[model samples]
Target: MLSGQSFMMFVVLLCTCAFAFLNGFRDASNSIAVAVRNRALTPTYAVLVAAFFTFVGTMASTSFGVYLVSAVELGVPDGIPGLALLLSGLLAGGAWGLFCWWRGLPISSTHALIAALAGASGASALLGNDGVHDAWRMLAGGVLLPLLFTPLFAFAASWVLVIPVTWLVRHSTASDVNGVSRAGQAVAACAVALGNGLQDGQRTGAMLTLALVTAGAAQPGAIMLGPQLLGAGCLAAGVLFGGWRIAHTLAYRLVNIDPLRGMVAQTVSAAMLFFGAMLIHLPISTTQAVTSSIVGAGTNQRFESVTWQQVNKVLRNWLATPLVCALLGGILYLAMHPLVS
Candidate 1:
């Protein structure tokens, strides 16, 4: 017979896996959409490459996981209540991700996860004398700031990079330009995939680690390789199985993706993500970065070709994701509090 703590730990691991899968499923397009859209790689080949790189990138670093666990202080009670809180947050985040995937909306899973955790923490705090001040502070500094700024930075950076590059290569023959762009797209896609793996992979790993600590299976400072591998593998599987609908939305609906534009946007997005992960130590959204870069590139080359309607819809989804997931997480925590308490 399993101990009660063991059972709760099992549930937490399952929820973590599910959350990782949904994260990969919904965000896979961020790494591959440009390459597929530009015909630099077939859809099947792009997915495989993206999966492989995602795995490699995830295994390469655990810094983001460390930051998430240390920085975000959720004031939930430890043990069973903590497990319940984690499960609730994961469920809320995963639900929002699946909903967005179904609707072909490329919203930020990062934001959903952060907001869900915030909501659950807030709810837990409410049950005691403490308010959600720490949760709010962490949410604003660790999550919201990055979410707000990175996309705008990517947008401006992509526009600046594309305009000059386009002008410099304006005199090149069409075939030459196409060939160079295809090569660039391939390389940039791989970079984006790697970045996604590192940032998102660490996030899921951190969640699993937190759960393990709560269950007494691991210490707070310890990050087990098994859970990290499991998270990475599940993420790759999600990339392989899901992502077409959101890919289409990102690749075709928001802006026309030519080989040159695709390469530039992908490269810029990957660079921004890498900078954030390494230097800033922030877990920025690859989805937002990639999509905004694509839009920026399009706007620079041919402003009229960009579809503002689709862009607006995506923006709305981005804005709504955190709020919706927060509410869902709060409701779930409230419902589970009685049982867990």
Candidate 2:
């Protein structure tokens, strides 16, 4: 928007937009691990298989509720500028995500983006009360809540469920239960695939919905079918690309995952994500959901096995995200305002 031809703007969009794709690759491990690690599917072929299914599911879905995500909340003011808002916040958030990827750290794109949106919106809010209440409530209720809860729910579900299931596995260890576990793998795999569709795919859909509005290709306030389908397709394609570097960190390092743990985590993440998505047509963070699930699963293995250090790191990022984004948004909005005006 700068001088109506800032190459930097386009460049930033290209780089920042990839966060959605990276998000899927990074989180795919939650679903693929049980199948791949357990030899239910070879890594290469398994991801390919997951990729194909994920893509299909996303493309097939409609975008009826896309509005929930295209807009973020923070008690922002009206004069902040939408172009500046989208550009600066996304750049900061996207850069944050890429920075973590470079360090081989698995962080949440949701946290980064939400922080960016909140920061930028709050900066604008200082100007007037145009979009304040709508945004902040959303940040707290829609985006932040799900991301925070994914792990909490995952942790609690696994905490209560894993012990009993583990005991059962031990009990059934005698009579060729391996065969039964193997048999159960197919069904579990399907559930994981559905989880991917509802979980990761929705975030992509939301962003795409916003992009279309920003570009004047669509209307605002409500999400539509086209953007949703497009977003889902893009996300599924991302999963096929594979994010092995960090996926291994999650699946292997998080805990000694077996089929039951993997499936349960996937199922929990999917349940929460899908419900959130359908509730407001907003794309919630699968990264948060699945990460929480893994963390929860880790606790089920014993709190000692749970990586509190990593959890602390994640929490720190979550806490700092908004402040950093707010500062970035304020600075960039001021700088870009005159040019756009």
* lDDT per model vs. reference: 0.82, 0.60
Cα displacement (angstroms), candidate 2, residue 175, comes to 8.6
**What is candidate 1's local distance difference test score?**
0.82
Task: Go through the candidates in order and give the clash count of each.
Answer: 0, 13
Best by lDDT: 1
Q: What's the C-alpha lDDT at position 170 in model 2?
A: 84
Which clashing pairs does model 1 show?
A: none
TM-score of every model versus the real structure = 0.95, 0.79
Please give, for residues 58-91, the per-residue lDDT of candidate 2 as tens digits: 6544443433445342322222255467666667
Tell me model 2's lDDT, rounded to 2 decimals.
0.60
Best by TM-score: 1
Candidate 2's clash total is: 13
Model 2 misplaced regions, further than 4 Å: 1-17, 60-67, 71-80, 127-133, 182-190, 221-225, 279-284, 302-304
